[model samples]
Target chain A: MRNEFHADLQTVSQLLVELAQEVRAAMRQATRALLTADRRAAEAVIAGDRDIDHRYRDVEERVCELLARQAPVASDLRAMITALHVAADLERMGDLADHVAKTALRRHPSPAVPAELRPVFTDMAGVADRMAEKIATVLASPDAELAAELDRDDDAMDELHKGLFGVVLGADWPYGVETAIDATLLGRFYERFADHAVNAGEHVVYLITGHPTPS
Target chain B: MRNEFHADLQTVSQLLVELAQEVRAAMRQATRALLTADRRAAEAVIAGDRDIDHRYRDVEERVCELLARQAPVASDLRAMITALHVAADLERMGDLADHVAKTALRRHPSPAVPAELRPVFTDMAGVADRMAEKIATVLASPDAELAAELDRDDDAMDELHKGLFGVVLGADWPYGVETAIDATLLGRFYERFADHAVNAGEHVVYLITGHPTPS
Candidate 1:
């Protein structure tokens, strides 16, 4: 009976790691859809979000079942509960990606971003991608040191986000209302994606230390 | 031991209700501050969020301890787990309110929103306040039918949001870039608040039905 309980716990952990990778792909896919102005890809992200949401529900149900049947204790209970929180965050992150995809679809036919801001956005995307990867690693290992590094990367994303906003808002080209809306929504998507990544990192710290990071 | 366990479970339920009420106040106070541009009120909301966040963590920890110590079954486990998710959504809703308050600080003395849109915003504030109240009520009594009604109100917030964007974007006034930014951010806060309300309603449904809402 004990061996079966341990096996169930292992399955839950494996699901947590898989969820992280799924979220990372969704984030990348959503960004790619935006950069390329590909309506198909954007639509794909929206549809794929349903699958992510479903996976989150599935994982939660399984965790609850494990708790009920296996009666996990202490660290095992904390791990299951952490799994629940991280899965929800990951699902919301996917939803944010879907928001970006919808925004991209709304502004399709390739409305170009200002050249000056492109580098900032590109950097933001890279940071977002790396944050997702690091979150996956943290879930797999619960490494407190690695989780602490997420804050530095989040700061970089914040800096790039500000630059992106400054360039778009200060532009002289008058790209019209559509351009303004797209820029605003896109910036928010990136900022929130980074925020959720930071949240995932916090969960890792909590899982290891049994407390959330200080505000 | 069983009697003590039941008493702790009752205490957990009471704390869950108290947390819901506190979050609702924080949300309403922040939104009112935004509309009135009350800096002190906004600052209060900002300071008060830590309290909500801290209390949320406290409830979560207590719930975890209960689960570990008592090993609740079936409906008891469901209620506890649902509280965890609902508290999270409530906490995030508080954050969205704080975001709105900060924007209010930035846009202080915001040129009076045009005459045509003043009532629209008031209507929005009404819907938002009511939604927060309903979320609290649902948490206090998961059996209430009011939660389903609140879920429908989410669609009303979306409709009002569309009207807000149309009026602002369609206006000829330069309104400048700042108005555009304000409109976008305000729209986002309202939408997200509604989304959290819907999440709370879904939890209520899950509590009664033993499953999450239908896809």
Candidate 2:
């Protein structure tokens, strides 16, 4: 019995999944630019963020309209609300990706991280991208188990983030103040990206379990 | 002809104002901690963030209940949703203040920013506190004009933020990589705090005008 409400909710879920995929690609691309100093890849990520924002707004409008017209019951209401918050998280993930790209651009013709630290940035991005992937997966079908995995990925990101500080603060660090600042900020951007992914995963867990996790 | 819905919504608005004030005080206290290296002040800000998060969650529950029970009309719904988001912004502002406090604590027995940069942080905190005040005022009575002023305040914040980098990057800068990283992150925390305030103000403007400005 696919009524208008069901059809529209389905569409919204699909849109969320697609948006998550877009954000994931953006993160991966930004990391590529960061590791290789690829101006073109960086430019593409920066340009792509607007479309992500546009789609985010589209999701917002749809969710609001759906809530208003359908007057969804309790379960449906929770799903709608969770979708709204997840959309916001996805949009922010896009912004983090954009920040990563800009960091790369700022050091154009120069890798954003030192050669020794490139592996760390790569691993950080890997964890973040994996979290985004799981977020997208859980959105398509609420999987509390799958959603729960993002926390583990986030721990990996934190470890990498801490190791980055170690390198920047190490005595042998010759890059100087500017590079250290860049690395510090870049590390933060990825860490935040991973965090948003984790939050979005929690949103999915709430959707499935009907219990908001402790903040 | 005030119904239960109006009464509940009124309570929500008042709660938001109080939360805004609390967040404002936290930021000011954090700055004091940053400048004076006052361990007690820093510890207070850190401990106080839990209360802020609890209040934020309370607002979220109230808003959801109001929407579900009342099924508010479009205009009222917009206000309810906007309040939900503004509460989130306020809560995050508290988190930023906590970040500032932790930075102060990290360099305990020593200030976070250098002596020369103390004034910059002082001025930045002042503008941020003023912005929080306006947010509280606008929440009490939706004032588009007051909300509009946040953008200008945000511009002032940007100038200060840029000036901070200039000082940090100056050739005569005595602080080495550690202090530079600390200053960079602390500056980012304040800048983000300001940006969230501006966004919250825009949310108020949207509530008043019923037109969401471009993203």
Candidate 3:
């Protein structure tokens, strides 16, 4: 019975790792759709989110069942709790991707953002993509060091976000009212995406260290 | 042992109610600080958020401890889970209040938004305050009817948010970029606050009826 319990634990951990990968892909696809102005790709991201959500519910149910049957202790308990949290974060990340995809669809016909702002968004997109990937790495390994590095990546994302907002707000731009709203929402989407990545990193640290960072 | 378990459960429920009150107060105080351009009031909101955070964490720890100790079954289990979720929503609501306070501080003195748009904000603030209070009531009593009423309040807040964004984005305002960004972020804060309130209301219904609303 004990051996079977460990086997189930291993299975749940592997599933969490896979869920993180799916979440990472969803984010990447959504970012690519935003940067390249591809309606088809954006639609795909929106559709794919349903699968992610379904998978998350599946993991949640399985984890709860494991807890009821196995009654995991110590590190095993932490692993189950961490799986529950990471599933929620990954689902939220998928929602963020859907937000980006929806924004991309809204701005499709002629590129809603100004030409000059494209580079800033390109950089922002890169930061978001990297953050998603790093979150996956941290989840897979549960390494305290990777979690710390994810914080640095989050800082870079914040800096880019600040720069983007400054350009939109402080600089003179000719993008009309509609375009400006799109740009603003897009920047917010990226900022929120990075925030969730930071949250995932924090969860990883909590799982390994048993303590969350000071607020 | 069972009596102590019941006592702890009552404590959890009582704290959850108090958390809802603190969250509502935080939202109202933060928005009032913004509308009045009171920097000191905004600072107060910022300081008060720490207490809200502490309360939420305290409630969460208490609920988790109860679950670990008593291993509640059936309705009790549902109630505990609902309390856990309500705490999370309340915590996120507090974060939104903090964001609004920060926005207020950034736009102080010069008043980045147009005086004309003040009424829109005023309307949004009123709706948000009402939503928070109504949700708090529903959470305390676990009333499906009141929860449904809170959902209706969300509609009013949504309408105000949409109108404000339309006005801000439809025309070229004289305040330049700060006004637009401020308006956008302020609209986001109210929208997200309303969203969380709606989520809390749903949880209340779930706790009472044993089924959350359909997504």
Candidate number with greatest TM-score? 2
Superposed Cα deviation of residue B161, candidate 2 (Å):
0.8
lDDT of each: 0.80, 0.91, 0.79
Native A-B interface contacts kept, per candidate: 0.59, 0.46, 0.17
Give residue A31's error in model 2 in angstroms: 1.2
Q: What is the lDDT of residue A134 in candidate 3?
A: 79
Per-prediction TM-score, chain B alone: 0.91, 0.97, 0.94
Question: Which portions of model 2 show Cα errors greater than 4 Å?
Answer: A1-3
Give the Cα-based TM-score of candidate 2 against the true structure.
0.97
Could you tell me which 10 consecutive residues in candidate 1 chain A have the lowest summed lDDT?
Answer: A109-118
Q: Write the per-residue lDDT of candidate 1 for residues B50-151, one digit (tens) a residue.
A: 888888888898899989988987988887898788888788888887887787777666633445566777777778888888877766666657888776
What does DockQ come to for candidate 3?
Answer: 0.42
Per-residue CA lDDT of candidate 1, range A91-153, in tens? 888888888888778768773344565677678889989999999898877798888888999
Off by over 4 Å in 3: A1-4, A73-75, B1-3
Ranking by DockQ: 1, 2, 3
DockQ of each: 0.69, 0.68, 0.42
Query: How would you encode candidate 3's per-residue C-alpha lDDT over B88-174 as one tens digit per residue?
Result: 788889999999988888878655457878998888888888888887777656678888887778888889888887687665565
Q: Model 3, range A1-215, lDDT digits (tens) per residue? A: 77988799777767777777887787778877777888888899999999988988888778767766665566666666667777877788888889888888887865655777789888888888788777777766668987777778878888988888777765577664566677778888888888877887887788789898655
Candidate with best lDDT:
2
